[model samples]
Target: MALASAMAAIAIDTLLPAFEQMRPAFGLSADSTQLSLTLTLFFAGMAVGTLFYGPLADAIGRKPLLFTSLGIYAGAAVVGALAPSLEVLLASRFVWGFAAAGPRTLTQAIVRDRFSGTAMARAMTLIQTVFFLGPILAPILGKGLVALGSWRYTLLFGAVSAGVLALWSLRLPETLAEENRRPLSFATTLAGFRSVIANRTTLGYTLAVTFGFGALFSFLASSELIFVDVYGRPSWFVPYFSTMSAIAAGVSIANNQMLRRVEARPLALSAGVAFTATSGALLAVTAASGGLPRIGVWILLFSLANASMIGFAPVAISLALEPMGALAGTAAAVVGFCSTGLGALLAAITDRAIAGDVMPIGVSYFVYGVLALACQLWARRASKPAHI
Candidate 1:
């Protein structure tokens, strides 16, 4: 389940190290920001895929849909590898992301089908801990592959991984029970969608996750440019990127331990507070430094903020899906769509604002942090018992 969820991360992070090689190969300028479109468009595809995959998973079965999606993912990766132009590559990436969303969304539903409450939180935390390995290792792997050949090698690697995962997933039994299956119809789908939006706690935490994702996405879309171009640390990009991911992964492990004693809601709220604080600090430092803080200080705060945002994710998601019951598939889809689809659009604003400094990243994170915290607080309030 963890490995399947990481497919999207693998597709995205593995390609980051190839940006330098990709520029010259596609006749783009050395400073071109057009490559960021790859990330955004892929996210756009995921957003769209979520609307269909969730309902389909609930209607059909998890295993069949998963297999079909993985097969398409492999094919899309191959097409991306052979793309003759930037437009073709971006188009293929969208298809790849659309296919990847099936696995990503289903992992949540499958887990929900098996566990709930604190157990679900722990399972998700552990899955996320394992999932972070993709981001930590993919950049290094991509760099090695790019060194050996070209960016296309990374795409080919994604194809190979997807094929292997598809085979491995055959071991997974269909978790959705026969009686729990919902009929595929416009009315049923609309009802599922309505249920998700009408639930206060679910909608609130989903939005919290969305804004948190916006902050993370902004960092991702701009990190390479900030490190390689602004700081002139082309060689340090992978190490730094991996280190940030490592911090988030480490925090996830710690969070899993913390969850044994702490309630997921309070813990998630604390993480949101920490996220907002760290983001505010980054913004203050960036503003004081004329939109370019010292690299050491910047990375330190960035890692903390990133870690906090990641820490809030599993628990908040568990909370959002808790009240969902049999609606887990649709609810997970709505969460995935809002967080990835809407979040990517929000991050694009910051991505385009990025030029020669990290100010936009800082500003975007601060704003997103505040919004996420607000949503978390609202969720907590909404989850409380009311008395006359």
Candidate 2:
């Protein structure tokens, strides 16, 4: 699950520092940017893959479905590495995104099948922590490769990671018992989706998770640009970026620990408050300064808020899946797909929209903050009092 979970999702992080190398090679427009092409894989993958992976697991068995997905991902990584033009690269990214659905969603389903309630949340947190850590390391590696090798190494890393994960998954036992497993046919999967979609709280929880990541996606889309383009930080900025990102690790673990004490909903509220206040403060400072906000200050402000994200995201996802106990794989896939896809789409669009000036990012963060706050409110209103 760790390899699978991280394998498909770190595409952008792995390729980020190489944006300049890819930009001219692909002939991307100044405004359109490599950002769109790079981010496309995740959004498209999450959206469609979510719809597909669940039934695939149910029908064939989770192990095979996972293996097949990783196999496809390996092929797509080769294509991305060898892409001759911008259009080809974009197409490859889209395909890669679709292939990613398997690893991301299947991991969730597999986890739920093995555990439930508090243990389920703990497992979810563990998976998230692993996935989160991947991005932390991916960019520095990307930078190192770009310096010593080429952007192709990033894609090669993907292929190798996918291959490694596929081999490992082959060795793991299927947790879904035969008697309990529903044959994951298209019709049956759709019926399961229908049931999930029909539940108001479940549906709302999905939306909450999706919108919550909107801000994070916005940051991912712009991180390289913010450091390199705006702050003029070097390609090695990955280390600095990862340092701030590590703050999320501690907060994530803390959230998981607190699960035994406080409700997920309240944790989410505290996260929302931090996210909004920090984004707003940064936005206001950037605006008042009339230009560049100090890198150190911005990093400190965003890092603190971002750290809490580790806790907030998993809980909401667990909430969405709680109602789909038996269909945990299917539910996790659905929510994973929607949240990531939407976030990617938003990231790409916002990246394109905010290209000329850095100020727009401050605005974008605040806007996303508002939406997140609203979603949290709606999520709370619709749920039973979340148990501490």
Using lDDT, give the best candidate's number. 1
Candidate 1 stretches greater than 4 Å from native: 384-388
Per-residue CA lDDT of model 2 for 15-120, tens digit only, reads 8878877766666653345555567665676678777887667656688788888888888889988987767777788788888888888888887787665566
Candidate 1 lDDT over 1-388, as tens digits, reads 9999999999999999999999999999998999999999999999988888999999997899899889889999999999999999999989998998999999999999998776788899999999999999999999999999889999989889988898898788999999999999999999999999999999999999999999899888888988888899888889988988888789989989998887788888899999999999999999999999999999999988999999999999988988887898899999999999999999999999988898998899999999999988888887852111
The TM-score values for the models, in the order shown, are: 0.98, 0.91
- Each model's RMSD to truth, in Å? 2.1, 2.4
Cα displacement (Å) at residue 385, model 2:
5.8
Q: At residue 116, give the lDDT of candidate 2.
A: 62
Worst 10 residues of 1 by lDDT: 379-388
Q: lDDT of each prediction vs. the true structure?
A: 0.91, 0.73
- Candidate 2 C-alpha error for residue 161, in Å: 0.8
Candidate 2 local distance difference test against the native? 0.73
